[model samples]
Target chain A: MKEGTSISVSKLTKRFGHFTAVDAISFDVKEGEIFGFLGANGAGKTTAMRMLCGLSMPTSGEATVAGYDLYKQSEKIKKSIGYMSQKFSLYEDLTIKENNRFYGGIYGLSDKQINEKTEFMLHHLHLEDQANTLVKELPLGWKQKLSFSVSMIHDPKIVFLDEPTGGVDPLTRREFWTMIYEAAHRGTTVFVTTHYMDEAEYCDRVSIMVDGKIEALDTPSALTRQFKVQGMADVFVQLARKAKRSDN
Target chain B: MESIQVDHVDKSFQSGKSPVEALKNITFNVKQGELFGLIGPDGAGKTTLFRILTTLMLADKGDAWVDGYHVVKDYEQIRKRVGYMPGRFSLYQDLTVEENLSFFATLFNTTLEENYELVKDIYVQIEPFKKRRAGALSGGMKQKLALSCALIHRPSVLFLDEPTTGVDAVSRQEFWQLLRGLQKQGITILVSTPYMDEASLCDRVALMQNGSIMKIDSPGGIISQFQKPLWAVQGDNMYQLMHDLRHDSRVDTCYPFGQYHHVTFNESTIDIESLKKEFQQKGVHSITIDRTEPTIEDCFMELMNQ
Candidate 1:
């Protein structure tokens, strides 16, 4: 494992009855780094992320996240990290500030801290104008942005962003990534999973999981150069094509 | 005459507390047999405009014309002339692919045999799954089925709103190919997508944001108008390179594109050799510098900032 890594796994496997969703995957996520977990739809990326976030139990193996043991120290891990899934996971009926308060309360933040954090998120996301608007009333992109900010209301050391920028415009996606980079620079490690190969290339290091295995793990340039490809899309294509060949 | 025109169109919703403006004076036109695109983020009035043109919804103020038929006054004619595939897959899930095609054909008082040639190329792929439920098929299949259904009526104009959002890359490529094939048949297409790369596939695109057109032109024409010198810079320390370039006065905008960071410099005062020296000074080696062209994303970003 890398020194002072925030996440580590060894022989980590997750299965549901006959189907294995995560199969003996081992990787380390360094502190204050942006680690990308890439996979197509239904490629076990979500399953693996669930295991790491202590939301789901692994069928077997050892894993540590945010320096908490995956098996016994799940609560500590949960408290130390933030998670945002494909679903907004925010209350649609509640106003933007109310949703943040709800999430902040569940994460066990003090009322005062929640208020400060709520204000910061609202200001940072330019949501001050829409703070009182119901989340459902807001457009899809703003809802996504607010949900992402809500994920970190409790001030977690690490954040898990799962396709956070899906279906957003390029300008919004760009601004969102800028916020992610800012978070990383402030000593927070970002563990994100996305289907967008181009977004994956922006991560410091990315791992492509296919059929419950980390088929490739390297920096975007390193992987692309090693695979004799031009971009992350080509690298993923080549790897995915190879898997189909093996299956055939 | 404009092949398609929306004259001062406006739409509003009763928000209980107050009125909300969904669209405001949204005026634009597309030429006949010209592939036009409505490029915008979700809920940016692109769908509102499309719905108005397709005769699904009405505009509160002004009117739209498809193939010279007024949208509000000549609703039936507008419907007959425009093929619309909504952003969401609204096909009949229970029906088979062939049944869905026939149903849409019947909507326009037409038959499958009357427009079989119009949809044959797309229908052939799903022909094997003619009996399979539309819901049981894959995303690509579902999209193909939807497209075939839309074209079954032989509309002179087509409209697709963010059609490739959830589909895979391969499916997106194939969907565009099908659209291109249809476009060559002398049908005008107005497609919208948040994906900037797909912007190039359209003959002309109107970059819409916040219920307004930012820029409208051919994809190449728009990209060529990007006002900066871009370079793809890479080195051992990418993380640091990105961080450093963001604060560099010489670097106007630096975005991580694939393996390298695409950096743009102020066109009036760009010093490439000095920038290379600065990169070297930061312990960044293996720095390869080259003039990079602006992509649709860059163009959209520029347009948005403007």
Candidate 2:
């Protein structure tokens, strides 16, 4: 793995009216590393990802992604990063190749680049035979893989995956991580958020979020060691239990 | 009496130009006090089979019996005698957890007091939020509520379709423990999960794919059929090990499981000494190879390949 630019976030906050979805939180993601963003439902993982991907503005903070400013250079930040949202962001009715074309064009990729990228992605996903198949007809795993590839159409420096393998089978989740590993090995910084404890183990580092702040953040092994747990799954439960107690 | 019995069942759904055969001659029997699992990914016909077995739908071919009664001939009796928890949260969102449980109990012409002992362990967990709307609860809480309602009627058989999907790991473990408790009370459970690790929790499992039974056996039995000597290998250079093993002629199948790659040789006669030598020759310095057992995932992959 290659060393990536140090992402610096100082007291990042995102508020929607009275609800502070992502309350003053900060964490750095190094280059060429898989960082797991973990949280329960509505634990602000999505809100934080939205801010990092430059899709939403932070209420107050100084942050940079891939060395670009998160505020004034938001547009540049978007170009330097890829984001696969929870929802299927691709065109449902479009053909497999057509969705790729649509995403590439939207990312300002030229015709030649789009053509090469589509061909490469299709072959890489072993979906060359199904390029003409409508996206609606594909299985959940194929659609997820294809969607991830499309998000990287512009060759973003960092890729943000929000539950990219969610709703798929465990087998597909394994295959999906292989692709994630491939991306990281190729010097693409992988920033992902998932509730699956096993998926967190696949990452080099993980941050467990509770309430609106990160309760624990470190290498998966370190977290497991500090929490005195045998696995990440148990570690997550311990944190969740703490949160539940506080709420009570 | 057999809890559930499916004999030579087949299901097909018409898609525009052709029909999709979901299940092919599927046959299995769940014992009176066993926790059976239909383990596979989505579109593996788990839901369809469960629906037919629970008397929610009729199979196009073959017949199934619940509690020794034909599914078609005794549909009403089956419904009364079996508890079905669908994959989705089908409970009334507007009703409180207590209300939901009582409603389900009422459906069976029984009161909560009559079946309180059956679901006491699960119901106690949700009793604190008895007045909370079903939809307002957390994922884990909602799951417990669903199971409580399903058991409130004291059904002889329980069918939970992917009940633990989208839930936290701890919740999943807890739910399985609850199932085991019910099994001890002479309740037969048929649970479907896409998770391979949970396969071992079942008394017996049937691995399904594209509507066909790939294999049906105990988890240990299925893993033993791997027919290859497996090894858990880890080294300084995982990338190199993965690449080398994938292309290695002696390696039948290699997959990254957690921190190590579970590799297997095409022929069991190949000794670990020789396999280590081959890896060392491939520049995998300081490799650790130890005999490892195959996982349900490996077994499923092998079955799917064939």
Query: Pick by DockQ: which candidate is best?
Result: 2
Give candidate 2's error at residue A80 in angstroms: 3.4
Alpha carbon deviation, residue B214, candidate 1 (Å): 1.4
Q: In candidate 2, residue A86 scores what lDDT?
A: 63
> Per-residue alpha-carbon lDDT of model 2 for A1-248, expressed as tens digits?
12456466778998888877777887888888899988765577778888888888999987988888888898888878888976788887899889988888888899999899989998888888988888877877788888889988898889989878766766677788888989899889999887566678778889988877889999877998998987788888888765542111
Give the range where candidate 1 chain A is weakest over 10 consecutive residues by summed lDDT. A239-248
Worst ten in a row by lDDT for model 2 chain A: A239-248
lDDT of 1 at B87: 81
Q: Which predicted model would earn the best lDDT?
A: 2
Give per-residue CA lDDT, model 1, range A63-115, as digits (tens).
Answer: 99888899999999999998887777889899988887888889888899988
Clashing pairs in 2: A4-A31, B22-B211
Relative to the unseen true structure, what is the C-alpha lDDT of residue A196 in candidate 1, on a scale of 0 to 100?
Answer: 69
After best superposition, candidate 2 residue B288: deviation in angstroms?
1.1
Report the lDDT tens digits of candidate 2 across residue range B1-306.
677889999999886446888788999998899899999977899999988988787788999999998999989888889898999989999999989988998888998899888888988888899999998987778888899888888989999999987665656777888988999999999999987789999989999888999999999999989866778888767777888888878788777776678887777676777777888888887788888778898899878878
